[model samples]
Target: MNSLRKEPLGGGSSEPLPVAIIGNGPSGICLSYLLSGNTPYVKSHAVHPHPLLQRKLMETPGVSIMDQDLDYLSEGLEGRCESPVALLFDALLRPDTDFGGDMESVLTWKHEKERTVPHVVLGRNLPGGAWHSIDGSMVTLSQGQWMGLPDLQVKDWMRKKRRGLRNSRATAGDIAHYYRDYVTKKGLEHNFVSGAVVTAVKWEGLEPQDSGAQDSRPLFQVSGFLQNAQDPSPQPFILRARNLVLATGTYDSPARLGVPGESLPFVHHELAALEAAMRAGTVTPASEPVLIVGAGLSAADAVLYARHCNVPVIHAFRRSVDDPGLVFNQLPKMLYPEYHKVHQMMRDQSFLSPGPYEGYLSLPQHQLLLLKEDCQAVFRDPRGGQKAFGVSLVLVLIGSYPDLSFLPGGGALLTMDPSQPLSAKRNPIHVDPFTYQSTHQEGLYALGPLAGDNFVRFVQGGALAAASSLLRKETRKPP
Candidate 1:
């Protein structure tokens, strides 16, 4: 498993190098696995193995995983793990189990490819990416089957661990463990370099042309700091690649509610404290109501966690109460009674009348004006009233956007569709849906949630699309 070596970064090489994969999350891991032409890990019950995809990947090589934190790769294995879907077991195996089943298959696949292109992974910890920071016990929004990467089946992993598979959803811990196992079982760990952070990605203009014509082929300069040394200071280095992949998903930058008092100690952007309370079974009712801002899954989780602790909830959102486009509508009410109940209670609230629920209050189309130190929230109420509500804690979960600040030129090198509405323009990095390559830049690419495929199940498509494009480019390169 430790066969893959981390090569030192040096210049002056004329050989084609591996594609630099930034952010070793599921998207990056899957891309690397596919690009390596390793056999997909299929379980015993896997049906309709993806022979087509296997054939596709077998032709491509030279891919690597890069990340700032590598510890995330194995974080899930350390705790109670779950996935939104049976990602590892069902989804990945359903369409193509043969491509990604076991070590023997992977070895055989490699031998068949003949010329194995060496790939290197750079990171500070494991390649779990954002999953490492997730709460181990937190259940995913989707079922377990939908959470698998392209090769590993989460359901199979759970089965091997002797964990119950009856539950539709898997925990965050389950996903982390699956990633770590995938890297080890697939023999990808050797290629991984711990303690590396990609700081800048610069697309150097084409080499000076003797013919006085602009060269279409661009050389990319990827600069980073490697912290593998015992010393605290990071060692700065750079690598040159033909292409660059940005798999750093949106979770890195959380959307903020830019109101006054948001910096206060009582305000929390995440539910770590609430999750801890639920795990401890500390249901002691709070004296003050907990304020939850936003309408997404995180806000809903906060409401549920607060209610589980018998703490009063004051849910606030900008969406109208009657908005059918809410995320809750996507869930099956029969299976998720709490979400259904909460939605119903919120819907019962009226502008003219009080809500039926005594302890829970839902405020729609209201903006948080300020969060006072004494657990007080000033709101620009939807009913044209400036109201102040008492609160012990504030959970703000409006949503998250991608942070491409690390990109050179502050995102101007990227492009957005001018035809897109003003609101959509806020997300500036537009890419070809089929290729995942930036519409503006030639060699730059984006994948995962950053590319707009928010769900885990669909993330594989982005990776596949990007890999396909890069492989095509590789084939086109002159010998």
Candidate 2:
């Protein structure tokens, strides 16, 4: 096995640091918690489930009702049924449990002996990343169960707090609060360094090996600025670790509409900015028929919020209403009646229209030309037709890309292929899908949306894959 070696840094201790996880979002929280080996509290008595509920849970996706009881299923059946939280808990927390398949050996290794490797998490705040930056009222597109970390079920947390049933969607604040609580419950708060922004991650190359021997292991120098509680200035610090995991998500850099006058005072990108304007009474209903760009979930949110404020909206999309795989087409109407209703209304052109092309205008393959001084938008039709529309405000809800600005060497270390379309250019870090280790850098790993696993429920798989890879590397003999 590879032994830990101490490296002297700026007069700091010579203790070897095994892992450093960047960003305290769900991915980082789950990885750090699992690495710490904190045992979850289990009830002494077996929980009995109602016959009807037991049968129902047995058919659930990630749930195996035989070993795990059904009483835990009732609290949040909606969310829990979709995520693998219960499966992960059973594998990692239960005594002598088999993780099964290829993971059986990797996960069981932790229980065979005590782990003493040191690890730390760096982030800007307790929640960190997009979860901390999002608006409080923003509800997730996925169910609450999908939001659970590896060890703690979001349903169990909600039940303990008497919040609500597990089937409901979680608000941004709800998810953020759960993450904070998870850190405290897992005793990971001591390992977390808040208000610390990792400015750069540099590869220190491979250690010098004996002649004719190959060394695949690489060292990483992680440097960042820690914000002082009292002082405005930040203190610089450096940390060296054997492995690095980046989970800083994709919401760091938002995509922009490259049009003239995009910097106008009335243009906004996020829904929070528009809500703030409404609260300040700066934007009024008289500024009717707000022009919204994009066709994703964020644009839908802007439309709903505008409707709530009694403001009319001109929903503009680049594709036709009959476009394949639209957000509305995929959403279950019964589960999201309000969203379905609003989407239908927009399609039927029921809302007030400020232009000639009805309420629902489809600018199929359209190109935005300019945003005029008088709050007018100029765009070209798919067939070389040009049109102008009047609007009080323009909400650009275009999606965001992953911001890997902190990675030194620009494209040298991680490059966006020029062959791919502009939208897919900011592709996530390239990693071995099964291991989640960087294809180019040996010791670097990525998780969460930053690694292209966008859904919360599915992100746990990436974490597991990464953790398993780290364990194998750490325990393997150099030979």
Candidate 3:
């Protein structure tokens, strides 16, 4: 199981992997773990809050996650707009809140080399995926405990690195380092193709009759660029896969304001850029007030960072502070004090304040209409009065979606709505709850945010579901 089993093609080259994973984020990592012969088993006398689930696991001797009835475990536990399998997985892993309660895992890993599935994880970033790109100092929305993949705990990984973490509160840097380390530590680095940008994934029809591996033919032709670390130039490659899993996540593409000067040198899309500028002394107290746009958590993070650095900020957003739909309004004050402070500033119209929100101008229901040559941001307020603000930098943290341009018709075939482009924000891909396979296309599956399971804790379940489906299919195949 240490080496991926692959049949050689006519020219002494390896054939398409039996299963090809897109995006080596948590989803891909989880799949890599499960498919690499690390089978899961319910621990005997495991303490579970759900009696039915506990009994189900105990009654079935030597029950495995892949062989369990996932739908039965998911019933009455999932929300209206939640992945049921994810809920079941969370229950199995944590047995309570994702924050804490389960210091130990309720399951055990059993290595079975014969059950290993030949697969490759193709990702555009390092093993950690987009998490490595986030601002290191910035903390995650969810606690650190919710961020770890199966088998390896975040706290344990931190201990191995000799880092002292007193609580579940973890910085982005900690999570990022953990994910990158998890790959090598778990012996998954060999299967991962980092810095891979998949350009296209088209159905390439059945394999030739003379192929060596007879279980399944190459169903997908995956085309992407493999980036060179030293050269910075991309190396183009084409691959075929028997099964394609879309665990790509939706953080790659940043949603645009679609206005003038948005592409200007002063404007920025990600928080990482702003953090970089601050560290480089480009953004300081002497600099013009930074104009922060959007109504999401990222926008709030911008405000918090700017205010902490003593840099003035002009906050602009579409929704009012009182709007129930506003993300800030929904967040509890206790867990998210920094965000609550930003929300308070928006509600109180805190401008030129000297306290927590000093030099902060909160403009609710304001729109940025234009950005001038001299870093001037023209905005239309709620009263329809157009005001201009002189700012050093502009940040648009509106939101993001998965870039599915590689698929046909912008991946409309996999989405619930074929007329619209594939987007997790607009509509999650239509997938079977049990298998996580694309309802529209066979041998094509989705995991994580693509399948509407957006939380870090829920990612493992999606991979587990896909693994179960793949294994079941293999069992039924003719010898």
- For residues 1-479, write the lDDT of model 3, one tens digit per residue: 12212321111344666788888889999989888888888887676777777766766768687787888767777532377888888777777664436546788889888778877888777887888778778888877778889888887787888875534567888888898888988888778877777899899868653557665444788887777567566667777777899998999889899999999988999877777788899988889988899888899888888888888888899887789999887876777787888888877764323345557888888888999888999988888889888999999999898988899877777888877766776788999988999998888999989988887888888999999888765444221
CA error at residue 455 for candidate 1, angstroms? 1.3
Model 3 lDDT on a 0 to 1 scale: 0.80
Candidate 2 residue 305 Cα shift, in angstroms, is 0.8
Name every residue pair that clashes in candidate 3.
none
Cα lDDT of model 2 by residue, 1-479, tens digit? 01111232221764436788887887787777656653222222322233433344445434222123323433333322222333343333322222222221112212222332357777777654478777767777877765777556677898898876323687887888898888887667767777777788888766533367776567788886777566677767787778989887767667898889889988888888778878888767776568888878888888878878877576777776667667888887766776776567556662233333233444445667889888898887667778888888888888987666677744235423434422222565666766677787778888776666676666665665666566555654221
Model 2: which ten-residue window has the lowest total lDDT?
A: 1-10
Give the lowest summed-lDDT range of ten residues in model 1: 65-74
Clashes of 1: 42
Clash pairs for candidate 2: 76-166, 78-167, 79-145
Cα misplacement distance, residue 147 of candidate 3 (Å): 0.7
Model 3 residue 43 distance off true place after TM-score fit, in angstroms:
1.1
Highest TM-score against the true fold, candidate: 3
Q: Pick the candidate with the highest lDDT.
A: 3
Alpha-carbon error at 324 in model 1, in Å? 1.6
